[model samples]
Target: MVQQRLFGLIFALVCGLLAFGSVNAGTDGVTAKQAQEAEFELGKRLFTKTAVPACALCHTLRDAGSEGAVGPVLDEIKPDADRVSKALRNGLGNMPAFKTLGEAEIKALARYVSQASGGAGPSGN
Candidate 1:
């Protein structure tokens, strides 16, 4: 009787283990917060990287510590994310369309600029 009970227990444990192992579940990949941080970092790099013209070269942003006089002061303009994104996508006035940047890069840059300029909500509203 004791041997039978021990065998039953072992079988149950093995079955439970197999069931747990066979169950497929999606993994918790990088969180939204992590993705946002990564995007912000990439945006910052794109803004100031040497290979590109660098937004910092023409705009003044406290975060970037850029004091460029050619473009409107980002600190004063404090444009929303949507506004910034549109400008980057289509350009305006003296600014040329940043067609080279990918959509994702442009979005990231807009979010970064808006957030740094005190527009943190969605669409920087």
Candidate 2:
């Protein structure tokens, strides 16, 4: 009877730990998702802001709901993350280099564009 009680106690402890771990994991998952959503919103803001000749100014993106006619249509081009990052970093064609945007901003923008364009991240993330 003592052994059975001990076993029951152990089982209860283990179950409690497992439940606690599960709750912690769920919280972490929610936090990570919230952070990602915030990053996406920031990228969208960067893409649409006028302070830096917004990406939306020249490109048409369905996800961004942009209908710009100056540059290529981003929805049709469907640029990968790397291409978007490279262009943001080094500029392309008639586009001038945007050395002012921080690296994190550039990465966020690249990720946003890749995901919005219906492609995976730069290298499938």
Candidate 1 lDDT, 32-113, residue by residue in tens: 4555676676667667662147899999999988888899998888888888888888889988888776665676688788
Specify the poorest-scoring 10-residue window by lDDT in model 2. Answer: 1-10
Stretches off by above 4 angstroms in model 2 are 1-30
Model 1 TM-score is 0.71
TM-score for candidate 2, residues paired by index: 0.72
> Which residue pairs does candidate 2 place in steric collision?
none
Off by over 4 Å in 1: 1-29, 120-125
Tell me each candidate's TM-score.
Answer: 0.71, 0.72
lDDT for each residue of candidate 2 in 84-106, tens digit (9 for 90 to 100) = 88998898997777776666567
Q: Please list the Cα RMSD from the true structure of every candidate, rounded to 1 decimal place.
A: 18.0, 15.9
